[model samples]
Structures are given as structure tokens and as C-alpha cells.
Target: MPQLITAPGEAVVNRYRTSVVTPRVDAQVVKRHVQLGDHVDAGQALVTLSSVAMATAQGALLEADTELRRVKQLGRDVVSEKRFVTAQVAYQQARAQVGAYGMSDRQIDALIRQGDAARADGRFQLLAPQAGTVINDPFVIGQIVAPGYELLRITDESRIWVEARLPVNEAEWIMKDVAAIVTVGDTQLNGKVVQLHHQLDDTTRTRAVHIEVANPDHRLHPGQFVNVVIEGKAQQAQQGIVVPKAAVMRSKDGDWQVFVETAPGRFEAKEVALLRTAGERVMIDGIAPGTTVVARGAFFVQSEIAKGGFEIHNH
Candidate 1:
């Protein structure tokens, strides 16, 4: 059985499954389609904003569209090659500028279908890039926000990360993809080690191990402390008998011993050296293979022996 290393861990949001919402241009928050803690879907409208820069870009696009159409209608003999190319480039640039201002391709197509420059209102909606819960929505309606400002944050809580801190020596025994058990109070959750840090903490001399856990019911939350038991690879080949941990007990002299069945319905205490522990199983020496050792109810056998005043120590 593999050895187990226990460590302290904390649940954290998985950054890979989180998204930040920000505007590319300075805009005023006109309205909010969702509030904090609301579940949202991909392409859902999250908020609406109005920007003067977007209005200017829209007008420029409309003008460029008209000019391009006029140049196309005219014969090549009437329009110079440079004039035709310049009109096409201007139209493309204007379209790209509007898109950069947060106008989706569909919205741009609608704007072109309208064909009325007077209708360029500069209002556009910010959409959810992916399906997630709205963990943060800090902006309010009518607030003027600058470009690159974080207006909202969406995160998928179905799966999260638990960062465990292990001692330098114990961490060296484990590697990525090792199975781990996380204990949150009395509940035990299965996880796997996804990352191992090479650098040690300056204060604790411990290495960080990241374990990914599934939270299908959203029971796990960020900032919660947890106990993590990582299954580590054995440092050496197994050479001892593996038995249930309950089969081993400390004798009166504090030596680890197990109950061995010497005859039918008779048992004797035999001292054994503890080698390693893997959860509820322990590997021990001072015992031979094919030996009839009481795996379960060993404590009961020990109690019966103590009643008879039998010597429990090995010479």
C-alpha cells in the first residue's frame, strides 16, 4: 500500500473557469441585465452601456458604407484604382472600430440593415462570454466606467481547486496526478493532485500542492479550510506484510504488536515494527507471510490475554 501524507489545504476559485467582464472603450452603464449571484448563460445579455466613441465609430461606418456603394456603382474608368481601394479600406476599418467598441457582428449587421445614420444611438450590450454564475457585479446604472475597468466577474463553481501545503520532505514523495482525499469536517471528497510547486515557502519551508476537486452540488466554497490526505508513492519496494491498522496495538511497554493465532481459538501478542501507513492499512515487519494473524478483533484478543495475566511483551 502507498503511504499517505496529510496536509492543510484551502479551497479556491479555479481561475481557468473564471471570466472578467470589462469594456474596451469608456462607457456609461445604462442598465444591468443580471445581478450578483445570478446564474447566466453564454451569449446572455449582461449589461448595457452607452459610449460617445461608439456613436462616432458607427457614424463613420455608415458614411464609409455609402461612399463604398457609390464608388462601386461608378465604372472603373470613372473612379481611380486608389479611390476604390481607399473606400474599401475605410469601410473595413470603420467596421472593425465599431466591433472593438463592443458591437457584436450581428448587431453591426442590424445597424447596416437600418442604414440610417441618425439611428446610431451608441448603445450596446455586454454579453456573458460563457455560462457561469455572476459572482461579482460592482457597477451601477448611470455610472461612468473607464476602459479596462473590471465591471463584473463570472465563475463556474462546478469544479474548484484546493491548495494544500505539505512539508518539503513529504511533498517530495508525491507527484502530479496522485490521488488525494480532502476532508471538510466529517465529509470526505476525492481529489487529484494537479500541480506541485518546486519553490518552498520562505516562512514555512513547505511546498504548495494544488488538488482539483469536483463540486457538482456547489457545496464547496472558496476560502474554506480543509484537510487533505495525499497518497504518496512508496519510497522503496514493499517487503513487509500489510495488515489492517486495527490489527496493530501498542503493548504495555509501548511497543507496536499484533495478535497472532497460535492454536485453535488461542492467540498470542507478537511485537511488530511499523513501516508505513496508507490510510487504514499499515505495513509492518517482525511478521512472516502465511502467518495466521488476527486481522480483525485483535483488540478483543489482547483484552482477553490481559485478563489471564499473560506476558504481552516479546523478548
Candidate 2:
């Protein structure tokens, strides 16, 4: 019978993720504009923070600008060239300090224009790096976040992947660019095999197979377990005949046996190899295609053959 290889797996959000982090030193979360599960766009404000270091940087910028302006008012001869150059360098360093504090170029320009009004404010906004839904947010309004700490996570859910594990023995059947199906709840999606792991999982003794599927409506989520049905397109080149599970019975010797009808009312008992079972169907190899075989009452046929009441031959 035509068959499909299946394995259990988990659905994961696609690789596009953005981690929102606080700048350099410790900062207090003053406001949270976005919450968990909120959809955000690129450059949208997600949080507001207050930093002492940012206050100091802004003060220095204001001080440097004041000194540079005061020195410029003096004639070139009145101020030594070395003194003017030193003031200019101080102003540039102050700008660099604010830039390092996570202030964008436009914000820096506006602050420079605002002069003392912008000094010591220290209020800064953290914007989303990409358009995605917020999946993780671990901050409170008054929380103090350490330097470089991740405040939130944004994930693009337009597409998702299923990571399935197959036994090492089945590794030979897995290949790149194969067709696969992922089933989650009542939803079944067609996916493409995107990756195959070279190493086996030490504990499970299974290899990883990654299948990517489209989730345009954001229906699939990470950490959701699903079933993966892999179509062994290459393995199908060498095929086997399919039979009903009831047609195959276990012999007293612990081997699987099936009865095939060679002629009218004449049956034979043959041992068959079990490949894989899906639902009520079993895929076997010893049976030939298009040959009439007992689909029902197989146990009686096996009993009749065992009793030697009828002629039995291997088909």
C-alpha cells in the first residue's frame, strides 16, 4: 500500500525575532507602552526609561555647547588656537556620549537645538526594532532593569516551522526539500522539508527534521506540539503492497502471518514483514499487488490452515 512516514514534533515560531534591550547602565522603567501579545510596528514606542547616566550625558552636552559658544564670541587672536580646538573636541565628545546612550541622530539634533531645556531630562523611549507581535515582556512600571537586559521579545509569526524527530534508522529516508504535512489540532498544513540534522539525539536516538509552513493568520505558535507526516518521496520509488491490519495475525511462534487465497476456497498461510501501521491499515511486503487476499475473517482462515483441514501453500 502507498504509505506516509510520520513522527511527533513541535511547532515553533519562525526565526525572525527581535529582543528589545535597555541601553548601557541601569535604568528605571517609567512607562510601558506595549504589553505582552501586543502587535507592534517598526520604530513604535514600546517603553520609556529613566537613566541617571543619560541625565549626566545630557548635562555634559549642554555644558560643552555653552563653553564653545562663549569661546567663539572671542576673537581668534583673543583666544589661542589650541584653546578653541580643545573646546571643539569637548563638544564633539559630549555628542558622542549622548549617542552612545541610545539617542538617535534626529533626537540628538533636536536636543542640541532645545539647549538647556533638554538637559538633565533623562527620559528616553525604546522603540520596536521590527514589525511583530510582542511575545515576551518581563518588566514592571517601576522595575529597575540592568544594563543590556532584555525587556521584551517581538516575533514575526507570518510563517512557522515544525521540528520533528525521526528514529535514526529512518534517517536514510529523510532528505532536503521533501514534502511533509504538519497536523495541529484540526488544522493540517502542507510544508516543505527545510533541514535535516546530521547528528542524532543522544537520549532519544532520533534525528531532527525541520519543516517550514506558512501561517499568515498567526494561527501557529511556538512550543505547540504537533504531528508531522513525512512523505518519503524517494523511498516510494521502491514500494510495497498495502494490506488491512486485520488480515495479518500473530502466529503461536510470535511471528506475524497472513493468509492469501491462491484459488477458490483455497487459502495459504505466509509470514509477512510489518513495515508501519496507520490507523486500521498495515503496510506489508510479502503480499503481491492485485492478488485477491482475505480482507475479512482472517483469524478463521489462519485457524483453518493451522488445523490442516485444507491444503495450504505459501504465496
Candidate 3:
């Protein structure tokens, strides 16, 4: 496998989750067309709700409609102007009320066609706002629900975010649109850096990075912990020199040092910045690439220098 800059992260649901609601007041779920995990289309009915407010709206519409027709037939000669205007206004108000109660134009037309046979039990269908799978359905048939109650939650899981808290110093590498790898168990997914938080966590001192990954198969789920690898840009990687892991050692001062060979059997300890590690090798800065170093006997060199054979050099 290629060298990776690894971080721990977890999968999260995309922000497009929608809450299905009954648009009218005093609604009770009478029928449920979809259950949890079922995929549904936009405008698909998920449940049928019965409401007193809807029933009243429908009844008033029918009454006002009938009265308007009767007054129109009577003409100005038969009915006073004030009475005629009052009847017209009442019919318009009733129609608007039915619409405000969540009845669609098509539904209102259908009800009008049914006339008295259309019972205004306040029956209305709650539809899916978008095409997605039902992830949550908290209501059962015969359950009394109120307006704005979240009856169900629908989400399109094809796209998701992998949120990771990275060390504050490493935050600079997470640029928007940069490619990242998300590993869920044995599966590896390709994604891109979508976001980076401006502020660091006060407790962890780490910056949050969000990687957007495609999960068309739905294999990645929310709350699943995964491994994320963000490879630095090509130029950044080139700037760091790769050396044997054994060549790097910790100094007494807690700084990472490397043994650079200045002459035959003569090694000098030079402080180097450790960048990334891969297997038995590491990438470091402040060292020229291809320079000779005590790769295998670095620890021996450090011991010899510590014994006062020669004063260790910091450079």
C-alpha cells in the first residue's frame, strides 16, 4: 500500500434528511403506506392522516359552493347587490380555507366533483419530500399526531460525510477538493475534502475536517468509525526526504535527531523534523535527499557520542 497520512473518523448522515409532517391540525395517522428502510419517491404518500380541521374546511367549501351557484342563478334582478357580493366573498374564503388546510388543487377539485358524497373526515396524505429511503417512522396507524409532528425521516444515503479531528498542525494539509481515502474495515473509498473548521476544539486542540464520500451501495452507515488517510499534495511530499526509520532517534531533549555521515566512520547527530512514517521508513524535513547517513547503526552512533567519544552536533 502507498504511504498514508492516517486519522481516525466516523461516518455521519448527509445533511439532506427530511422530516415528514402532517400539514393540518388535529391529525391522526389512519394508514401507513411505508415502513422503515423502504425506499420511496418524491411526492409518494407515506401515511394517511384524518383531521377535524380538514373535514370542517371541506364541509364549508361544499356549502359555500352550493350557495354561490344559487345566488348566481338568481341574478341582480332577483338578489340585492350586497347579498350577491357577500355570497361571492364567502365562496372564495371557503376555498382558500380548504387550500390552507393542506388540500391540493387536484384534491379540492376531486372533492368538489364528489359533492355531498365526499365525506370531510379531514383525510389527507402525507408525502415524501424527496426521493429517498425511510430511515425513521415513529408513528403507527391510529396514532394521534399534531401538526408539524415528525412522523417519519427520509434520507438519501448515497452521499455521506466522514468527520475527523486532526491535529491542529496537520490542518493545513486539508484543502477543499483534495482527495482523501476512507477505509471502513477492508473496504477503501475515495473521497474529497469538503470542509475544515475555522476554530479548533478547546478540549482536544484539534481541527475538524469533513470528507465527502459516495456510498451508493449503502455500506457506510452513520456512526461507523472509519480510518481516513489524507495524502499531502505532491509538492509537499517531495519537499520531505524519505529515510530509514532506524536512522531517526529521540534526543535527550525530546527532539528527533538523525545521524548524518560527515566522513568515514564519523557520524554527526542532526535534528530533523519528522513528518510521516510508512513501515520501516519515514519522511523527514531539514535533510537533503540521497545524503549518506548511519541508517542501520544510528543507535550505536548515538551511544558512542553520548559516551563522550565526540561531542554530538545539533545541526
Candidate 4:
């Protein structure tokens, strides 16, 4: 797995998730199969609408199509161009208008040719887009539903996550394969942290952290108490020269440089390349292990030199 480069975080479980306010075509309900507290699977039909208008539109398209075909089939010289166009326009307009009622293009065309459209009960078929438990109060038979009315509400409490707020600075280092131990009530399970938001809120100074945990046995609900640990190491172990963090300093020009102690009461300013840093120590190149390095108070020497505290070596 690739390193996610993660930071500290907390875990949470969201108990109730609602997907509501979808498009409903029909105004009146004819059949209702689901009720409150019902477990529904994906694609389960919850309700059906009475499609009176749907069937009517099919008939209209069929009539228009028959007229169009009859007029066009007659000797081309017998019908004037304008009359032909008028019939054509009428048929096309009827076909388009009926489609707004939710008939497929093929069905509308077929109905025009055969004078019979595939039966649209003018009723709506409500299907569960996801698997979850129904939070009823949907609709009773004879209830009128508008275009954007919410007929049903389902809560998929089984698959849920706690949306946790994390600090921006720490969230920036999140690794995709970050592992954390999640605490759910008295239970502890291993989980993975993912989808760290690169942007942070200016006012709250928080970033969104998505922690995904599996609840196969249905042990976890949508909203629950949990904690997250974001562990990270800033340094990589390898063969290299190591220097105390204090030995590295900025010059007047803001460049990184370290002083090498060539001998007792003797020092020389030498430049070194920094690799990575551990706690209080930095790994650098160019300086050997036995080479006397000014491990401490290098800044004081810089200050001393700035104040003319020591003699300059003859170049």
C-alpha cells in the first residue's frame, strides 16, 4: 500500500442517513407497498402511480402518426407542400408533447405507427436506489404528489461514517492507507482513513476527514461515538551523517549552513545538504562521523562573528 502521509484524527458513526426529495412524475398514488420501519433492498419498488394521462398521450401520438403516414403515402403531386408540412408538424408536435409525460422515444414512435403506445399507467414507479430501512410516512393511496415531492425517506444506518473535523495542518499529511484503531462503545476495530480535504475553513480552521470502517455484522450504526489516531513519522532511516538540530542555522541571506569544528578552538563555516529531520536531530550529507561538528550553540558563534568576536582566518 502507498503511504498516505496522515495526521491525528477521531472516528464517529452516523446512525441516520437520508436521501430525500427526488423527482416523482405522477400526482396521485395508486399503490403503496412500503411503510415505516420496513427494510428495503436496492431497486425495491415502493409505490406506483395511476398513469391516466400517460395512456391518453399514447393514443394522441398514434392518431397523429396515422394521419401523417396516410397523407404522405398519397400521390406526391396530389398533396401541396404546405399541407404536407402542416400534417408533418402536427404529428411531430403531438409526439414531442406526449414524451413529456414520460414515454420513451421508441414507444412514442411505435405507438404512432401502430396507433398503440406501450401502456404508461401514468403512475410512477418508486424504486429504492440504495438498500436501507424505510422511515415511512410516505404516501397513502389517492395522495397527490408534485414533481419534486418526497414520497419516501429511507435511512441506510448499516453503512455509515462519522464525519469528523480535523485540523488543517495535520490533515494535510494524511496517507491513503493510514490505519487506525476505532473505538465503538466498548469495541475496538481496525479502520482505514481516506479522502483528506486539501482545503480548510478559514473561520473554524477545520478540515474534513473521511474515516471508512466496515460494519459487516450490523454492529455499527450511522451515528456513534468513536476515536481516531493519525500516526506519522517525519524521518526515514538510512545511511547518512546526522547532526543535532541546533547545529543547522540560517545565514544573513537565509541560506542553511553549519559550522565544522576542524580542531579545538578552531572552526570553519561549511555548507551541508539536509535530507530529513528526526526529533532534535537532522540527517545531512558532506560531514563525516569523526569530523568534529559544532553540535550546539552554532547560532552564538554566528552572533560572535557578526559582532567581530573572533579573528578571520587568513585566506
What is the TM-score of each predicted model, taking all chains together? 0.83, 0.72, 0.68, 0.49
Candidate 2 local lDDT, 1-315, one digit each (tens)? 334677888987666454555656678999999999999998888888889998889889888988899889995879999989999999999999988887766777878888865556887777787888898888888999888888988887776788998887775677788788888888888898888889998998889888998888766788989888876755454356677889889988988878877787787778889887764678787877787778888887777767776764452
Which regions of candidate 4 deviate over 4 angstroms?
1-21, 24-26, 51-121, 135-142, 153-159, 201-203, 233-315
State residue 194's C-alpha deviation in candidate 4, in Å.
3.0
Q: Write the per-residue lDDT of candidate 1 for residues 227-254, one digit (tens) a residue.
A: 8889888573365799999999999999
Alpha-carbon error at 220 in model 2, in Å?
Answer: 1.5
Per-model lDDT: 0.88, 0.80, 0.81, 0.64
Q: List ranges where model 2 is wrong by over 4 Å.
A: 1-5, 18-20, 64-92, 171-173, 195-207, 231-237, 242-273, 276-282, 291-315
lDDT of 4 by residue, 84-139 (tens): 89888988887776666545465455555555445433544556767877764556
Residue 161 lDDT in model 4? Answer: 62
Best by lDDT: 1
- Candidate 1 lDDT at 98 equals 95
Model 1 has an lDDT value of 0.88
- Candidate 2, poorest ten consecutive residues by summed lDDT: 16-25
